[model samples]
Target: MDVHVVSKTDNNTHATFSLPTPTSPLAGPSSLRIRPSLLSLTSNNLTYALLGNQLKWWDAYPVPSNAPTPYNDASAWGIVPAWGFGTVLESTIESIAPGTKLWGYWPASGHVVDLALKHEPDEPSTHWIEVSPHRQTLLALYNRYLISTSDDETRHAWEASVRPVWQCAYVLSAYVFTPDPASNPAIHPYPGIPSVKETWTSADADLSRAVVISLAASSKTARAVAHNFTLRPTSGGPLGLLQVTSAPGPIQSAATALKPHFATRAVDYTSLDTEEVAQWIAALKPAKILVIDFGSRDGGFEAAHKLVSQDEVLAKAEFVTVNIGYQQKVYTMSDVGAALASAAEHSKIQFNTSPVIEAILPVQGATKLFAGLEKAWDHWLENREAAAPDLQLVWGEGVVGEKGIEGAWTRLTRGEVKPEEALVFRI
Candidate 1:
């Protein structure tokens, strides 16, 4: 990976520097400052912040001098990068390095330059470089902020950590639906009004019912969905939740915790033949189902299809489902296509996404506790709340450096990443 040195003003203005030839890898002989990137300065692109203002997206890299390798000693934070770079695609903030494996993004902090510059008149992309030693901090941030977010896990294992992705999620959710970020309840089964242009409230703001959370227990998104449902007035009756999961223990405990607010209940796949699942879902004739998982995509669609085929009771509610796992490498491009085809074939449902929170919400922040978000609004929908599944989030992949991106590009072009290396991260 190439590392470059950046010397800037207090407000991140550019300075003079020289590029080293192959023989002179250290300092450049040209005393004049290096040329700045001619790219237009857009408010959207940034690598650092100075007094909340856009500072230069200065490129930092490691010199790898004879001295020991240098690394910033920051604590853990997840929601960092994937393995390559994207031109600020999904999220507003994008960080690309020279060579490093990526998981996701966290809010970025300082960076150390590491690239050795070599000029090419035809190419200016490699002008900036860094080693990306912040991977550990990003991961730790994810575990701390996003994972331990539930009301139960408020005191996370690593409260000291900071992450960007988690912050994004909290902010997006808070911005869209609720205002209070510090303590969004564990079972917000009834999310209030949304500020977004498009939103889907309950079928009849007055006709309430339990929210059917698919892939419950295991998913934090589902937990949030269930929490949204619970906040509603029960003149529509209690938020009778029917959670489906293969893992009974943790899920049941989670559901149990959801108690009176959601009146939590559970069912296993094997029980589908019995009325156990049907009766539970039939209670409010749940108008909506919120899916918080991709791993369950196939099975979830099949289940919804079966229920819709068999139950006239649930026929009235429009089934709403959203897949946020678009970039999660759980399945390759082909696998995702196949999954879509299979879901369409099995279920009458088709996705018509609402851009309530379009950006990929990376979990970032203090470990285990919910910090406030930057912008949050209401969830927009057409089918209303009775629709099964209001949302689903699959942790997306991030961009790495040029060479690492080349390797991923080569593999992606051929087909996939080595299966073994993939297990390390959800992407």
Candidate 2:
């Protein structure tokens, strides 16, 4: 058994490890052996590592000490988390047979994982939830696996590559754009969308009158959210969308891939000055601004300040910064002010920013969130005719050995990958 491991102590470092394969996994009805078919490598995977401890990503697949490796550093023992497709090689459960396809989270290192399954009747499905008593309560979202309902190989490939990112994008789009229930009773974001029960800073200005500015606009998750913006009519004056990217290439790519009507304008963040960005915001004539940052080079502070500090923009509009992912090493946010301070340090344009809020999907449970995501996914699949961009994915199967995984990681970290390409690894 061979697996690649990343060093938590030394940033941007990784190694490959090998282990002797057991003829059979521990015998029991609960045991199953899964061999990964494909793996997704993206900033989201990096986010998993960034918040591994807080989010319990490290525990997804813990490596044993017996695994052979050059260096036995304990800090590098953990496998970085990945979302992908794995085929069940061995299963003792009667309902789930061998060769069954499973789509969910997996470890980046080991090719196969021996998981103890517990049939979670909690949800009506043929699949079972991982009931390894250790991590059962850690994070249910990462623990459950869905039985691949489709027999078509092509569909499975698409689902395996795009599902995890789309799932996140779907949830973000639903909650952020869902029309206020008080204003539009008929228009609900998700079929059974729950309220944001967690403590999120209340929106100061009328969200219905806001324009959403998305940072890292070309990202798959950002595109998904932007796509939904086009589909749903906003209560806020015409639903205006603006995408901000670091380079001109991403701007052109996003504009070309997404329908021309999807964004009002695609701005290259690095080229524009604060006043220039402010002018663009002023042109929208929005009463308020909602900044949805997917992954920014220096977080969204620079972008946030441009809107919040500009006299022309701030006089008429109030702004809110909503962080979705941290592409770099995770920073702690003790309070709103502290978060803004961190952003200010890395920002090109500095100003007294408004509330920097972390956008948490205000849903009851992971099950509910997944359900809402599936509902929206179905809606998109059914309405592909209506100016929807098909899922764009890049499969790398020809690349052999652990080199593919390491190379993918290096490219992603350096931001060398194309904006529209969703990387999937078959190692």
Best by lDDT: 2
User: Which candidate number would show the highest TM-score if scored against the true structure?
Assistant: 2
Cα error, candidate 1, residue 254 (Å): 1.8
Per-prediction TM-score to the true structure, in the order listed: 0.41, 0.78
Per-residue alpha-carbon lDDT of candidate 2 for residues 65-172, written as tens digits (9 for 90 to 100): 566654455556567877777888898877778888888788875567777888754454754678887665445567768888777765665566556666655544
Clashes of each: 89, 1
Encode model 1's per-residue lDDT on 204-256: one tens digit a residue: 22224435445523333344344444444455333465556555455555455
Q: What residue pairs are clashing in model 2? A: 208-236
lDDT of 2 at 330: 35
